[model samples]
Target: MLTYLFMGIALLAIGFAVHVLKWNILIAYYNTKPKEKKNNKNTESYRKILGYYGYITGGIFFLLAFLEFQGISVPPTPVTAVFIVWTMIVMYYAQKDDEDEK
Candidate 1:
């Protein structure tokens, strides 16, 4: 349980570090205008949805971790699965974005 909590915290910390370094692909995608494309509205909506997903996932992990720490036992498998899926999705987007840059 503690390991899962630490892992969740580490993931959130890494995300914050990425934001601080201004290396977040989603943010870049949201702000930069594409030379060939003209639909800013779609990107804007994507950014909003991604932002909400991040907040909601982080909050869920934090809450579950806190509850587990307070003697309320919570299964870690689901949390781990969620984190893994989220990481995979982010990596996919990142690679796709990188390919687009070229």
Candidate 2:
């Protein structure tokens, strides 16, 4: 059970990282697009949101890596399951948020 919790947390960290990478790539592509002025409000908003994701995901990855290195684990399966589900839901929302831009 504890192993599962560790594994799930590691997986959650991975999922978050994949998302951050995707968003950064998209942001870079958007920035590099041919445009005369780059001060548009929409571009600024997208950069802000991507910054938020990067900060949050980076922190999560750091914390999880520390926990994994220290071998920390929870005893309850239900809580771990909930965390994994919640992480997935968050990832879905993050991706959905980007869909409107497409």
**Top-TM-score candidate index:** 1
Worst 10 residues of 1 by lDDT: 37-46
- Tens-digit lDDT track for model 1 on 1-102? 566566557656555544443334635554465655434334444444455555556667778878877899877677678778985787477546656755
What TM-score does each of the candidates earn? 0.52, 0.41
Cα misplacement distance, residue 77 of candidate 2 (Å): 19
TM-score of candidate 2 against the unseen true structure: 0.41
Q: Which candidate is the best by lDDT?
A: 1
The lDDT of model 2 is 0.52
lDDT of 1 at 18: 45
In the predicted model 1, the residue pairs found to clash are: none
Q: Look at candidate 2 and give me any clashing residue pairs.
A: none
